[model samples]
Target: MDDSTIRLALERHWAASDAGDFTAEHDIYAEGAVLDYPQSGERIRGRANIRQSRLVQPNTKRFKVRRIIGTGDLWVTEYVLTYDGAPSYTVSIMEFRDGLVVYETQYFADPFVPAPSRADLVERPGTEAP
Candidate 1:
């Protein structure tokens, strides 16, 4: 796929996720695609399984994409994922083949306070985590 096409697919995927449209959200993945959560040491294989994992999650969810940058068949997305009103900074790395995602790994982390030693050299632009 062309850069524009891939980007559009990614945009659509995230949009579907934000809208809670599960079918649309998983449409970009190949049937055998795999998703990994390294922090939790979990790997979910297959598109149907991937979708099922999400479907079973009980939290009220929201996604706010900050940026997407990549080329060719590799892409990375950085975003804030909020569950039940708590935000977790998240990064998703995706690998594509035949214009569909074949493998993806996502990492999530809660925000942390800036170290006091760096206060003089850093500026804060976002609010503290709740």
Candidate 2:
């Protein structure tokens, strides 16, 4: 698929996710797509299985996309997933075939407080440095 097409597909996917619309979110996956959650050691094969797995999740979640970057058939999206008011940073790497996602691996991370020693080197989002 062309760059613009892939980008639009990704945007639509994320938008569906943010809206908590599982059907629309999973529509971009191919029938035999594979999804991997490396952190959880889980591999969900087939688009149907992936959709079912997400449908059973109990958390009330939302996605805030930070960035989406790639070319050709490989793409990576970084986003913050908020579940029950707790945010988890996530990265999803996808490989597409014929404009549909065929293989994907996702990683999730919890937020951590900034270390005191590095306070001068980094800036926090809302607080002003003293």
Question: Mind giving the per-residue lDDT tens digits that candidate 2 earns over 53-105?
Answer: 99999999999999999999999999999999999999999999999999999
Candidate 2 — which pairs collide? none
Instruction: Provide the clash count, candidate 2.
Output: 0
* Deviation from native of the Cα of residue 109 in model 1, angstroms: 1.0
Score each candidate by Cα lDDT.
0.96, 0.95
TM-score of each: 0.95, 0.94
Local accuracy of candidate 1 as per-residue lDDT tens digits, 66-127: 99999999999999999999999999999999999999999999989889998988766685
Clashes of each: 0, 0
Task: Report lDDT (Cα) of residue 9, candidate 2.
Answer: 95
